[model samples]
Target chain A: MDFVNLGRTGLKVSRICLGCMSYGDPNRGMHSWTLDEAASRPFIQRALELGINFFDTANMYSLGSSEEIVGRAIRDFTKRDEIVIATKVFFPLNPNDPNSGGLSRKAILREIDASLKRLGTDYVDLYQIHRLDPNTPIEETLEALHDVVKAGKARYLGASSMHAWQFTRRSIWRTCMAGRGLSACSRITT
Target chain B: MLPLCAAEGVGVIPWSPLARGRLARPWQSATTTRTENDQFGKGLYGATEEADRRIVDRVSEIAQSRGVPMAQVALAWMLSKRPITAPIIGATKPQHLDDAVKALDVKLTAEEIEKLEEFYVPHAIAGFK
Candidate 1:
């Protein structure tokens, strides 16, 4: 498994990332479905053995079961520095709570802590916006993410499910580029 | 998948070119794995439906005669199209993976490729709705 550098970040990950959305899947959603730990462990181990160091999960995956399994996998078997962990913030971990999810700084900072707790790590390799929130100003969102990195809670900030055309229209990520010590996700999907 | 990704620069990972084990028949996997249903439990592989069974038979004939797994032929055709980075190959057992990988080396002739497409045009089936 040849490792590909994720753009200019100097961080390299295998082309095949372990998408553990199946782990701890609870309810069957529209596009995403679920998978239990028993059915999922083989694939995760196989992916690692096959040289996949990138793991994609979210608070939404089986309502954080995916993160739990992934965190457990890394803690129980692999070293911390050997892999890059990416997770998203923007979905309601608690369906009943209106303020549990989104890109607002309060929400972003709060959810970052929660996601860290679920992932069982102090910092996430890449903390993504998950999806664009029209309600949260990009400045507020990026600044909050930068604060997390400054506090040593995260190394980088990134996003997923953003359409390419949407990325082209925004310059806020450019403001993110000018800062030191924080790199955003590459605009590529795998 | 490739076309979608290329237009978006999104990476392509195609899955189940074999119609979820339907391409090669006498499958060992339960129909549940082929297309797990909602609470209803009705699925593509459960009842030996007509259109699907015909597809299984036709693809099998092409693969057997050409000395390839039907899965490989189907996937190779997809890979042959542009922009796919990888296909999510699933396997219940070792042989399933073998069948998928074999298609990579098969290299269908232009004529054979056309014939396969003519036979199976990727029609939409029920239950997707």
Candidate 2:
């Protein structure tokens, strides 16, 4: 696989990233089509064999089973430091708890630790917000993510599936904050 | 979004570059277990299906002409864009991953790229907030 720098960061990632949303327990989450752990391991191993070093998963994927499966497979298939593992927050693991999701400082702080535990890793290569939280101020989310990087829980910060203007707003806010801008941003252009 | 990301040097890892597998096959040719149950994927398209179908048709034509899986054509089109760092590919089968990796080598000519993108209409922002 061809490796390239992830944006301006020195971190090199493969051109093809294995999305782990499909490698979860089907019975555990809303996606009934997800592969079980046994069926998923060979694919992860195959990806490693193909030289794909980047893997992306979300906390809400299979209600966290995706991360567990990805974590275990990565551990068995390759060295932790040799690959880039990315996970996201924002979706609530429990719908009953108001603070269980979003980009609020409290939610982010709690979710990061939970994700780390599920992934069986101390620090994720990249931590992302699954979506833009309309309720939270941009500054609050950016600051909390900055703190996540500061705390060494994640090497980089990212955001996914937001409007371009919203992303520009966040980027401008980060520019003002200086050294707090996101290193990556994901979008779905259907 | 691509321009802004290019200017800011933020890596753009787009999700669903295959449009939830819509671009990877003939227009509405078949539905998988995911398509049958993916409510989220359902919400992502349909608003512009009339227009999107033309694009899918073009992808099919190109794939057929090149003797490759439709996925390689779809992913090759995405990889041609300068701002894209990597397109996150979800694979349930082994060949799915193999097809994605092979897409890097399936270079689209300038004319082919234009043909693939010519039918794109601005979709109502789907996927997330």
Candidate 3:
């Protein structure tokens, strides 16, 4: 019910973001526990009724069904501009194609469009790296993400579950390049 | 990580704040379809179960004393952290959302916060590279 600025951005997001990883086609993804679309809709509706306007999902969650289901639910339950939708990239969706994942310029560019298509939105509120790509250089990833923001594909950027040094390195790179830094960072604090 | 994010003014949105439902219940008290089958979730806490169990037990103790659900206690603890902007809460059940929202109201005392946090030993980085 409470809204706060997302990092230093003027974009206000709900203090409780409804994570959409639990909603997808149960038969499609590795997460057998995922609720099917029929089961998932009520929770999304409830979250909206409870004033939760921020929703987080990933391009890989339920192999893209999560994004589809969430996209529909948001369209049915609320206005697109009223919600802060965050999703991540990385993790190969196609086992046959190594280009399907990571933070390379190719991967980032390709995945952003794929994610937008799946979510049925022209732009996402926040686009994030699901994890640091050891395979790709940080500058390539950062520049590609800067391009994403410049293209108006995403309003802000984020990274999840990376080392502090990796984050610091990316921050320094952003400063040097005079590019956009991350607006948010997600970590697993159990 | 929290300190650095705070200094840089980057919002910290923690995922799995309840540790994939581990912190929302008594230690090893129940198993959901997710807990039993989520390989990713299993990888996260398997190595540090002993330390995590102690933290879960403390969460349970505080929840009972406060007459609230264990999920609220765990979320209240997360909400107490200064740099945390929002916790990404995964809800399969409707009550999960209610519990997360109510956590905003369940403020913990400094002593309770200390008790909840004291058992956390350093964990090997599990979720990402």
Instruction: DockQ for every model, please.
Output: 0.10, 0.73, 0.73
lDDT of 1 by residue, A136-188 (tens): 78778777877888898877665554554454433345444665332333223
Tens digits of per-residue lDDT, candidate 1, B1-129, equal 223345434333333345455565634435543255433223533554565555566566677887766777766666565554444454444354455545556677787667665544343332222
Interface RMSD, in order shown: 7.5, 1.5, 1.7
| Model 1 root-mean-square deviation | 6.6
Instruction: Note the clash tally of each candidate.
Output: 2, 0, 0
Candidate 1 stretches with Cα past 4 Å from truth are A25-33, A169-172, A175-177, A180-190, B1-34, B37-129
**Local accuracy by lDDT, each model:** 0.61, 0.90, 0.91
Off by over 4 Å in 3: A188-190
TM-score comparison, 1 vs 2, better candidate = 2
TM-score of every model versus the real structure? 0.64, 0.97, 0.97
Candidate 3: clashing pairs of residues: none
lDDT of 3 by residue, B16-75 (tens): 888999989998888899988999999988999988899999999999999999999999
| Per-residue error (Å), model 3, residue B16 | 0.7
Give the Cα error of residue B127 in candidate 2, in Å.
1.6
- Report residue B11 deviation for candidate 1 (angstroms): 8.8
